[model samples]
Target: MAATGQVFLLLGSNLGDRGQVLTSAREAIAEQAGSIGNQSAIYETEPWGITDQPVFLNQVLEITTSLLPEDLLRIILNIEHDLGRVRYERWGARVIDIDILYFGQTIMDSARLTLPHPRIQDRRFVLAPLTEIAPDFIHPLLQKTSSKLLQECPDTSAVSKIP
Candidate 1:
């Protein structure tokens, strides 16, 4: 039997009610897949990539599920759509953004997905909350824990813990 896996997902919003968007996304994930192990406190930060857009609120979640990586990706996309996300440009402002940061220890490089997210190490928004939940979780590619990666990530973007 295929073993269920622990997956880490990153959620962010720069438009609408950011807090509600994050909550809704979390709930949506649960509805689609199952329970999330833990959800880190929300954090507000300046937008990356496209600096011209509004700042974003970000959070990371750890979920354990039986869904395969590709299926999980589709589910995440559906949740984003349900939450009013419209993808018109890269790094654009969004109502809700959901990204699969990691799926267990799987490292995949395909046309659709890449495990241990290629840019995760460079994004403070992703690393901060991730470290909060799984400090010792190792990056399959970098071979470093989330806490270590957070320490080394050059991104100094301001972030705060929210209830």
Candidate 2:
């Protein structure tokens, strides 16, 4: 195999055994891609966007993979579907939610996908754990570090670290 691609992903679950769903999603990512690298502590966070749902358990992980962005995305979607994630609403509570936060330093945007996920900088669920692994990781679009983005984010939703 070639050198694994460096990728960051945010995983969350707010329905049906949230913790177990997250762990299973992690396992699926590792199995379907290549290997799991470092993972951040899980977080219990208040729901954003759509509010009439359960609180979410979220975390970020650094994974090394040979899969391209699109292929990796498909794999994540498969995991979500397999784990019973319903595709009903935007920012709705889900059984498993997996988002590609960054693919190395690549910046891409298309009708179906966007690199450096558009909302990462605004969400504590994404940044809190990212800062743990790569506090200085630069946002390709904003040209700011993860720590800096976290500080600047206007989102005041509570996020608690969990093992």
Structural similarity to truth (TM-score) of each candidate: 0.95, 0.95
For model 1, the stretches where C-alpha displacement exceeds 4 angstroms are 1-3
For model 2, how does the per-residue alpha-carbon lDDT over 45-110 read when each residue is reduced to its tens digit? 999999889999999889998888888888898889999988999999789888999998888998
Worst 10-residue lDDT window for candidate 1 reads: 1-10
Compute the lDDT of residue 42 as modeled in candidate 1.
86
lDDT of each: 0.88, 0.88
lDDT computed for candidate 1:
0.88
